[model samples]
Each structure stands twice: as structure tokens, then as C-alpha cells.
Target: MASHLYGNYFSTRSQRVLFTLEELEYPYEWHSKDFARGEHKALPYVSEHHPFGKVPAFQDDHVKLFESRAICRYLVARKPGHLTPPFAGTSSASLVQGARFEQAASVEQSYFEPPLEKLGFELIFKK
Candidate 1:
């Protein structure tokens, strides 16, 4: 059993996950959740795996995990050859990099959300 990646295709976090997986050269199954179809709202599909009904969930062997950054860090640590610090066991660089990326991504979203939603409402929804 390798792993499974569940996310909306082209999502920023999802892209990051895919990039990290590719960098690590890990073999995994990918399931693209459709946003337009409201696939993420399905309880049976999410409750079994995700408590928050979110995308970018991961499953490997008997363990299941969520959160894009966490998954990326796990991949980098476990598969050092992929996007990890050169001195894996002796260095904290990879961990630091993962943390930095997470912070930046979160910040970008928080900064963009208000303006984005307002634009969509005024331009698309005519509100």
C-alpha cells in the first residue's frame, strides 16, 4: 500500500502536495475532488476520512492524515531524496522550510480572501 492524495485539481495546496510528492519521487494514488459538484460536502465520504470535510487528505497503510503542509513535510522527511535537506538526520533545514512554506501560504490566502470575495461578488454575482 503506497499512499492516496485527495484534493481539488489545480488548488494551491493541492499543487504543493503534488509537487512535494513528485520531488520525493513517491508513488501514490490521487483522487481529484470536484468543487463544482459539491463532492467535499458528502458526509459518508468525508466522515470516514476527514472530520472537517476538507480536501488534500492522505492515507497510507493503516495511518491517515490531513493538511497539505503536514503531508508535504512527512514526504520530505520520509523520502529525503525528494525536497529534503541534504543532511536529513543532522539538519533542521527541511523542517524549517516546511514551516516557512505553510506560513507563507496561509498569509497569502488571508491577505487575498477579502479582496477576492469582494471582487467576485461585485463582478460576478453583481452584489
Candidate 2:
């Protein structure tokens, strides 16, 4: 089954998912949503793609997903060993790596992204 992404190019969250897809070298179709025209809030986009009318919605085979972080995690889990360490093993080293990965991700989400997002919004959108 083919993978598909419905998102806007200007959306940072969409960029995150796009980066993950590129890093994994995953093949997928990109359906660009026209934010200017409120395409994301229309029709099947809101009803089928993303319930909240948000960008970066993804579909892989029968699985539909939203949230950039969730999409990245699903892509990583599907194609492991490139962007992440082996998470399947029950060994101590594997567990440590997994914990570290989660910690770093949490830090980025909680600490790094919020400030950057706020700054971007203030500088770009607010202007």
C-alpha cells in the first residue's frame, strides 16, 4: 500500500514529517493543502484527513494518522535503524538507548520547539 501525506508547505509540523520521510528515504505521495484558500478546512480534508482541519495528516495503507510527532514515530517504527536505534531488543543497551531517545525527544518537544514556535509566530505570522 502507498503512503500519503496531506499538508501545507509552510507548516512547521508538516516540515517535521517531511524531514522524517526524507531521512527514512520512504516513498510517499505529498498532497499539498492550500492554506490560503482554506483547503485544509474543506470537504474530505477535514472529514477524512484531519478532523481538526490541520495539516500534516498522513495515511499509510489503511492506517490514518495526525500529529507530526506521532507520524515521525510511526515512520521510524516502520523503518528502523536509520533515524533511531534498535528499539525491538530487550537488552540493557537497547533499553538505555530507547530511554535516551525518548528523553531527547521530550526535551525537544517541551523545551526547544515551543520557544521556536512562539518566536516564529511572533516574527512571521504576527507581522
Candidate 3:
């Protein structure tokens, strides 16, 4: 696999990763973790990939990464001018821009994600 994505189709976290890959036009092999079979919770996969046993783990030739947003950021960094504006230098403007980006990302993680994740869990996974 050129790159591999381990996730279920319906997971929002997985969707974020998929959207990033699509936006970047990057190709990856999708490995669906069968939720019905409890495959994501298995021993070696969980231990080696995600200790929390979450879906949406990613592996490319050089690295293994978990967390959807982190994976997206990594992908963007690989081709820095796409998806996000590059923080290319240490000029005052660049520093301020980088800080703003970090703050916005923090806001999404802290304020935006919890509620949406809860809603998705209740509506889709709670059954």
C-alpha cells in the first residue's frame, strides 16, 4: 500500500481524513475495520497503531500517525502550500499567522469537536 487508512466509512473522524486526502489528491489504500467483528479492538492492531483503539489510524511510507486532524496537518505539511497557507518564515506576520492557525485549530478541537462527536455517536453509533 502506498499509504493505508484504517477506519470505518461512517466515522466522522475518518471522514475528515478522507476529505483531506481527497483535497490533496493523495491516494491511499482503505482498510475498513469491521466494527461488527470488533476488529479495531484487537491486540496487535490496537497496540501497534492506536493505544486508545480508535479508528482512522494512518500509515504512510515514512510514518504512522493517529488523530484525524493531526493526520490532516501532516499531509498539508508534506505539500505545505496546499489546503493551508504556509507559515514559511519567522517574520512577525508569519509568526502571527502561525499563532492564529494554532488558536483556530485549538478552538476546533476544544469547542467544536466534542459536541459534534457526541451528536454523531448518539445518532449513528449509539444503537
In each prediction, how many residue pairs overlap at the backbone (N, C-alpha, C within less than 3 A)? 0, 0, 0
The number of clashing residue pairs in model 3 is 0
> Model 2: per-residue lDDT, tens digit, 73-115?
9999899866875575889988898899899989999999999
Off by over 4 Å in 2: 86-88, 125-127
Residue 46 in model 1: lDDT? 87
Residue-level error in angstroms, candidate 2, position 20 = 1.3
In candidate 3, residue 32 scores what lDDT? 93
RMSD of candidate 3 to true structure, Å: 1.7
- Over the stretch 13-44, how does candidate 3's per-residue lDDT look in tens digits? 89999999989988899999888898999988
The C-alpha local distance difference test score for the whole of candidate 1 amounts to 0.77
Root-mean-square deviation of each candidate, in angstroms?
Answer: 4.8, 1.7, 1.7
Best by lDDT: 2
lDDT of 1 by residue, 33-78 (tens): 8887877768765886677888888887887888877888788777
| Candidate 2 weakest ten by summed lDDT | 80-89
Task: Give the TM-score of each candidate.
Answer: 0.67, 0.88, 0.89
